[model samples]
Target: MDKTTTAAPSAAALAAGRRAGWLRELRETFTLAWPLVIAQVAQNALITTDVIMMGWLGPKQLAAGTLASTFIMPFLVGAVGLISAIAPLVAQARGARNIRAVRRIVRQGFWATIILSALLIPLILQVKPIFLFLGQNPETTMLAEQYIQIGVAMFIPGLAVVVLRSMLSAFNTTRIILVLTLAAVVVNAIGDYLLMFGVFGLPRLELRGAAIATVVTNLFMFVVFLAYVLNHKRFRRFHILWNFWKPDWHHLAQIFRIGTPIGMTVLAEVGLFTAAALLMGLIGTNEIAAHAIAMQSASMAFMVPLGLGVACTVRVGYAYGRGDDEGVRKAGWTALGLSTAFMTVSCITFILGAPLIVTIFLDPDRAANTDALRLGASYLVVAGLFQLVDGAQVVAAHALRGLSDTKVPMLVAIVSYWFIGLPIAYVMGFTFNLQGVGIWLGLAAGLAFAAIVLVIRFAMRERLGLLRRTL
Candidate 1:
């Protein structure tokens, strides 16, 4: 009997030990993740700020700005995803202590950014016809075109910022991003106030002014990040700017192979959301406004998981490069667990505070916004239900990217968003008479499918010891 009692205590002690180890890994992951979260949230705050200012202008301006952003966003986000290949590349190089590889990766990243910017500029310039083709309201389409024309100026600088931020964050120098992004947020808010309202002797540009403010903010952020990377002591070893402005075809090809699929994956996800936005426009202007408000709220909440996903890339990449498979698994799992926990809390908050959160974006006293506010509040509930799966999918996808497994995940995203999400959205919103709510439910279903498949992929790769396989 005494021996049996001792055996039970021993088993309990082992279980306790495993839990303690899990907590330690989680703590370390959070330590790296929080600065990234702060930076991402600050970065996204720029858009939130613009939306708030646009809302104050009127529903027409708000809807127009939101529509224009939807058109521009997929391209910008895809390019950002492309440039993000540099983060894992740099992290791996850092793990291997290969300064030359880091320099080569960043140089190719810069070239890709230039190439992507050139391609995207023409796309933004064609927004007028695109909006017309989509059958948008004529007046709103004209306003949206104007807004996008000005926003085009920010694209190049914004992509450059993405590359620089990736490099710095991969090096574990995240504090700089947090500081610079916070400063840019302040500048953006003040700039929008001055330009949008024409305060303090400035001409009131309204919607146009918002675009200008964003341009200035993007330019400022690029300059600051460039200055830091160039002048910082930490980067001196890599000789990052050696030959300054030359191209290497071989390295560029490597970047393209890895980054292009990543870019497409991002576009696939963004396309789903943008398509939903366009569908909302067809339903009605109020539906579009409500969709924008709910999406913006969900996006703000998403920043936390997005940042964690980024940090996981660095952690997992570093481990993979060092041939530490166990370390990679731990890092990946810790990130997923942390992300799920955080999103769980966010999900609860959104469900509980849906109305209060929606109220922040519009004037509650305004009769024009009544329908929008109601739809937005209800959409927040659907957003809440999917937050966990959304968080899981992003983390899993990023981890796979760290392992240099981009192509399969790209296919997963294509099937999940385009094949599954959109069809369901269309049928539910139109055919079934569910309208806007049905569309949102379809989004949740797609995200859930993505999360499940991605988690399985990650687990399979890790179990098979394929994570360390060369691309």
Candidate 2:
């Protein structure tokens, strides 16, 4: 009543209201972004940490790690993309209030992953000869083979973590991925410290030690995730482990049917990079070293958008699960918008600071790379321009998977990354003599095409009411 005394509701009120807004936005963003962000950052940090640790071992270790990661990618790639099947499937079951279905799906995913890992384990040995055939320097190949042989042993349990974690994510346990990934990263760091320097009375395995560190961390994460799932009330009450033991051949077939296209497409894209590494080797170590530096820098950038991509999948799946057609459309747009916004800043950072970034991974004094730095900067700058579309396409494609339309998007990715991207890069880098930048330009064109086509697919699916309907 004493109007002068009201005093604009005091400074504390303003601060509290501001804090409230921040909290609300954070909660929403967390719901939409945290799991995805953490997942991406953890993975990027893992590789970055690995690089930093392995750098201590020698340049040869760096080369070995690079070669090993690219080679086993195909085996891992198929499993990675295919595992997304569990998220949307479980999301749908959650939406339907079908606890039994969720349990069954989770069980089937484990079954699928185990089978795939078993098949891939044997292929790991073939990696050595394959690298030699690809013209890897004999020294690099020798160290790379050591890493591949020991590192891949983790695949058995690793696949289970991938599948099961995804299954839980489908149920809205998205935070688990970040939590588990963080745990794994810590474990790996300790293992690396112990194994790399002969800490704790352990033998110094060098590159092989790094590989073992990763495998051991993966194993620890698998057990942690499995224990959580098995002990959870929802899973236990439904007898998820006991009753959902048998495979649902039909659903399994459905997963392969829906998943294969996207899986293969992703495989093809990663395969291109692997082949590019090999081709760079043919140009000489100076070029490959520069190329590796650029690639690693981009890989770090790739993680941010990758996290966005995973978020897109979750948002799209959640919308589809709820039979919210408009929500699906909006979610797709929002995820892409988020990716574009994030990557736009990233693109600028890389293009402007490419040289500085490369320097972190390379010892400039001993580099012996005549024009690798210049060429690497140019390659990354151009590659940076395409980062937006690269992320957008990945998000859109995963959204399409939420719409249960993986086949078309898969085809689009395969054609764009392989038939279009690789060929262009090959010709530009060789035929046109554009060299390093040429390869990246090829990558740009492919990402651009993919972004456009996948967006169109997402739009078309939305218009047809596909998002609200089940397969």
Candidate 3:
């Protein structure tokens, strides 16, 4: 029982305790992340069903729908980013056990959604003129406009669903979100079949029918989720909707204050891809086709990290709200590690299965698709190279969001994607003649830069004074 022997046992016990704590955090992160991941996949399935059904109408209809979707997505994603602020806010409130604050935050989230929809719906409705100004074909623009007219109606409901989903996510009740989203996918598919093709004695509505189906699906999700939130024992205690009409300008403005930069950050990343597609178009038709196939594969792989990022925001926010600095560190690092591990597997898949993935999108036996297939396989290789950094950047950004740090991340994204990545892309793709490969390389460069910067920022949180405001 000398001093050295006693110290050894003490140190060993401390180490064991730390390991147990980390194991618990890992379990909690996984439990929260899986359902969110499945819900994300289900949401993607809803969009995929629309694309498949549009293809049934003919190439022209498919093209129009693609154009409309391209036009609408930036707005939709940006608005969702704004609404996403609700998650961290509600999570923090829950951790603080401030039920009144939770209700006020959610009420303001709904308000922000309404305000954003009002401002955005009109702008989206002007897609016809905007596309025309962008020099799109008049016929295709008209067709896209037709779909958008009805499709824009879903905007409000869609944002409302985000508000409700955010609240649920903060409570660690994401399973219902998954169930609802999967059900919506089924509903949307059936609606598309019956309306788009005039099945079951229905009149053929073509592109409009698809749009109508999307609107109905979104509305149904919003209404049903609202009902559940209102009536559920765990949720109704907060009385989130009891004073739905009363304005909480303070929280509303806080949402915008924290969320606008987030919205801009999303737009910046999206704009980079949109610009990359335009660059691919400048190269050749085969390149454009290849880019589309490769991008779709990357996007599908990205959903996992995106969902994990959402969970990170909540977990980290909870720790921040509780004023548990060690908890915050554990939550953030656990999520980053989880995301990195998953993306590592995804990267290996992309590297090893590029050709197989390309074949899934384009037939190898078709002469017309041969070039596109080769190019798509090459692009997937580049996608593999960027996978780790992409996952890192997203999770890091969300981790910072949990600490209410967004403005700096937004600036980092803009500078990385536009100034650093885009310039390299232009020089390599056009000036150096690397073409599609060069563009993909540029994307990797951008994501890597963002990942490095954001991760460093998170690591330096204490020195940067990011934890000072934590309750």
Candidate 4:
């Protein structure tokens, strides 16, 4: 007897299965991402708090602090990327249950952080001469130098926090990292109040107070995180403390090979923004202050997508380690979706609240700040327009990094920012007289370009099943 022919599954069934997969991926990514997002915001609080307190001092201080930070941030961010070599390694190790590899990666992360921090000191010391050579206002440049000098004191500890966070993020131990960063925030805020205003009879250090507060907060975070990682029973199995100082040249070299590109990519993006800030300095102090205010707000919003990117790296890295190509695709795409959704909301918020948001960093009642307030509000509009594209590119880049495909993304960033973005910024700001708005438009276009290219790259890599390829 012939059996009844079975019907193939309908399109509706296939669509339903796809929807279920997306829902499952989104839920998993959200679980991994939210705590990480909070941790990032809290960590940024260390800087945001400094900027806010500096704002209270007056416009000149704000401008000076902003300029100094622009120069120093590239170095700090690049160092973080160098240390980021730990994330994928630790994630993959955990996935494979290779405790020994995890320990070795952590130890080498420490070594990398030290080497990078030492290399940054000479650059930090020359800030005064460099800014002077750039024709910055002598008073403003000197103030900037003062702040950066104090800030350099915290580099090692700050990088230690980064390395420790990378490892914890891979293990999805973000909640603990969140708690520690929050404590650092509180300490930083209280310290800023005490030192900046001379509250409780402490010296009124003004901008220097902001720098000192940041340094203290860095130390607090590093010590607490180190203690937990070393003593906590959950980390005990890895024996991270045993031979912690042991030198491992091969692994360290491997880290640099993987890390240098990541570091350069970060520098490329940060350098563009920092270059914009410096260009604003040439326009006038008012413009510089306004740019700082608008950029600060944009940066706060950016932490959400930035954290999602980190989560994507860990999730995709874990899946890669396990040889789960499908898992890698799901993790990357879910992260992209989440970042897009969040940036949409943020963009809308920035547009609607431009006036109110810019005022937060300035003293609204002060007539002296009227120009800065007006200029800052307008700049926020530009900031709002770019949020979606900015989020897309950053998340896409991180997704590729997770798949160990950073070299191409680095090239994409260089071309997008240097060859395209900065040239437009210069032409518009000067030749076309768009000023600050023109510079910001260039940033938006560059991010859009990078986003399109990097997203396509990730798609192709997935299709080709190259997610397992490491540097």
The numbered model that scores best in TM-score is 4
Rank list by lDDT: 1, 3, 4, 2
Q: Write the per-residue lDDT of candidate 1 for residues 1-471, one digit (tens) a residue.
A: 999999999999999987887787678678778999999999899999999889999889999999999999999999888888888888887787777878888877888888998988997899988889889999999988888889889988898888889899788889899999999999999999999999999999888898999999999999998888888898866777788588788778877888889999999999999999999999998898899899999999999989999999998888888887877888899999989999999999999999999999999899999999999999999999999999999999999888878898999999999999999999999999889999998899889999999999999985655675462
Model 4 pairs whose backbones collide: none
10 residues in a row with least lDDT, candidate 3: 54-63
Assess candidate 2 and give its TM-score to the true structure. 0.89
lDDT of 4 by residue, 1-471 (tens): 123233344556778998998788888788888988998888787788888888999999999999999989999898888788789878877777777788888888888988998888888789998898988999999899889889889899998888888888999888998888889899999989998889887889988888898899899989999888888888867776678688988778877877888998988999999989989998999999999999989999999999999999998888888887878889998999989999999999989999999888999899989999998988899889999989989898888877777788889999999899999999988999999989888888888899999989888985656664452
Return whichever of 2 and 3 wins on TM-score: 3
Candidate 3 vs. true structure, TM-score: 0.94
* Model 1 spans with C-alpha error above 4 angstroms: 1-24, 463-465
In Å, residue 36's CA in model 1 sits off its true spot by 0.3
Per-residue error (Å), model 3, residue 290 = 3.5
Residue 63 of model 4: what lDDT?
A: 96
Q: Which one is best on lDDT?
A: 1
Clashing pairs in 2: none
Candidates' TM-scores?
Answer: 0.95, 0.89, 0.94, 0.96
Point out where model 2 deviates above 4 Å.
Answer: 1-30, 199-201, 243-245, 365-375, 463-465
The weakest ten consecutive residues by lDDT in model 1 span: 462-471
